[model samples]
Target: MKKMIALSLLLMAGMMLFARGSKESGKTVVEIWHSNSGPSGTAFDEIVDDFNSTIGEEKGIVIEAIYQGLANDVLTKVKAAASADISSLPDIAQLDATACLDMRNADYLILPESADIEISEIHPAAIEALMSDKGLLGVPFNASSLLFYYNKTLFDSLSLNPPETLDDFAAIAPLLGEKDSTGKVTRYAFAGVPATYELGAFIGAQKGLSYIVDEKNGHMGTPSKVLFEEDGTFRNFLGHWKALYDTGFVNNITSGISTEFAAGRTATMLASSSSLTAVINTVGGRFEVGTAFVPMTDEEATGGVNIGGGAFFLFDSSDAVKTVIEYFVSQDVQMKWAEDTGYLAINTALYDNPEYLAFLDENPAFKVATEQMLQSNPAVTSIWLPSAYQIYYSFQSEIRAVTEDGKDIDEAVHDMATLIQRAIDEYRAQNID
Candidate 1:
């Protein structure tokens, strides 16, 4: 009887030990909500899988992702979750730079230094976009900048190098196109939309004055005042662009600029570097596509292209969750992402990697995108304005009148100023000061 009791006690103790070990060794599951879809979605999943099998398995972490709708949809969902049940929020959520600004004050965000983030390894502009008074609001992800794509075939045939400034563009504009005897444009020198982003890039490239002024000690969420009208830079940009449009050198085809470039109907274009793969696929070996830095206003210009994209905002403050983010932003993973998706690598050192250098050598278009990124400035256009999208849409419409509808430059500028001021005033009045 004594022996049997001892045996039973030993067995119970053994089972307890086994259970505890199993519980301790089990992987911690980390959930990520993201808006990436289609090819981008697929590539992200592959990277996640790679992370799971390697770093994740070794560290006892399992990263899982759910495809929420778009970035805006995900933002809505996050707000809902934050208001209802804090426990319902995912460990990590992918949101846009703009939306992150709105949620800057949210208690859920895991700010920088929560983990070992190498701030110096990221582009300053990308870092700036996610920042608020509270510190770095999120981790930069899927970032991109404007790239100037030109046809190497055409450039070589004409013995013309890519333009380096507005003057070069002006000199080459009329020379690149074909006009009939009656001066009807049969081909175009450049193709772009009269949109806010396109116009903003031009303005920024010239080292023009700020479009929005940052008010120190103001409400962090609405910290900027619109200065587009008061600035001479905008007036000069409009006049120059309008003149080019008048000469039929700048084609205002709206949405078809990329198509025109792909079809070889236009000599040059400016597009998001994220579209590099699609552009290459569309070009389809017809001609060698060359990429160069978007021209500045002059040799002494000090400005950068705008940096825009989604970032990973942490809602659950867990060591495992932070691990997942660290892995995502690590140099190796970022380099892999750049290779697979043609999106700009978030790590600043990614451009210097030997593999990336080799890849860039083979893909000149991507190299151009990287070079352009080196000169990137913060996307200050509508970032702090309350009705940002509406303001931008209004600006786009007014600019189209100048470029496509023959509106006087001064008149169009005046109207844009009025529209933007009205929107800003309405926003300030409706919100708490």
Candidate 2:
């Protein structure tokens, strides 16, 4: 009986040792919630898988990426989680640029500096897009800027060049337009509803860089009022936009813009650089597609397009999270991400990579956005607002009133400014302390 008891004790000790070993050897699972879908989703998965097979395996870290839905959906879920329980938030999240304000306000965030992650290699414009008074709010992952797309085949046939300024667009519109027997425009020079996305560039493209809101477009602090009206940026943009509209070669077609452009019914359109792949694929070689920087308000304009798309925000300061973030920003990963999704590679080092240079040499169309971004003033950035959605919709509505309803430009601008100011006031009252 004494021997049996001794043997039993030995077995228990061995089992406990085995359990401890297993726990120590297990991989650290890092959960990430993201809004990337379609091609971007596939590319992201490949990146995760590559990391898991390589660095992750070596370091005993496993990255588990979960699709949370679209950008807005992810933002909603994140906010809800933060409100309910800060501990319940995912280790990391990929959210839209508009979430900058929300992330800045959330005290639960694990900033890159706190996590000891280095981000000096990222493009200045990209960093500026996510930066606020609090410092870097998030790391730019998939970023984009606006590009002016035109039918190269048509432009070449007429010996014309893509417009460099808004005035050029106005002058070129009549040349590219076609009219039916009744004087109704059959083919429009441009077809798009101007909104906040496009307006960012227009407002910024002024001497000394005009901002839509005070506080340097809400980067320094929470904005109390808009600057567009006082600065006359809106008025200046309207004068140019009104001229293009008065040419009667522009349309407010919101939907089917890509289709119309592809079908050769439209001459030019402004679209996000992220949509370049889709735009090209939609054309399907029916005509050569051309891309340029979104035309400036004038030749003297010093600003450029505002960075758009989503960024990665961390909630945990785990080494595993930092590793994953570093891996995503690596040169190979960023180059592949850009190639796969048509999003700009945020890594500035890619410009010097021989492979990337070769890729650009072979595919010149992909170079326009990068060139434009490099040339852009760092002051040009998105308007960070808590009521960004309402403000974006309001911009579209007010511009439509001017272009479609024949409302006076001055009245539309005033109404837009008033509505946006009200939104800011309401948001501050409800959310601010």
> Top lDDT: which candidate number?
2
> Which residue pairs show backbone clashes in model 2?
none
Best by TM-score: 2
RMSD to native for every prediction?
8.0, 6.4
| Model 1 weakest lDDT span, ten residues long | 210-219
Report every candidate's CA lDDT: 0.73, 0.88
lDDT score for candidate 1 against the true structure: 0.73
Question: How much is the lDDT of residue 91 in candidate 1?
Answer: 87
Runs in model 1 lying further than 4 Å from the true structure: 1-27, 80-88, 114-120, 179-186, 216-221, 297-301, 376-382
Residue 340 lDDT (model 1) = 67
lDDT of 2 at 332: 92
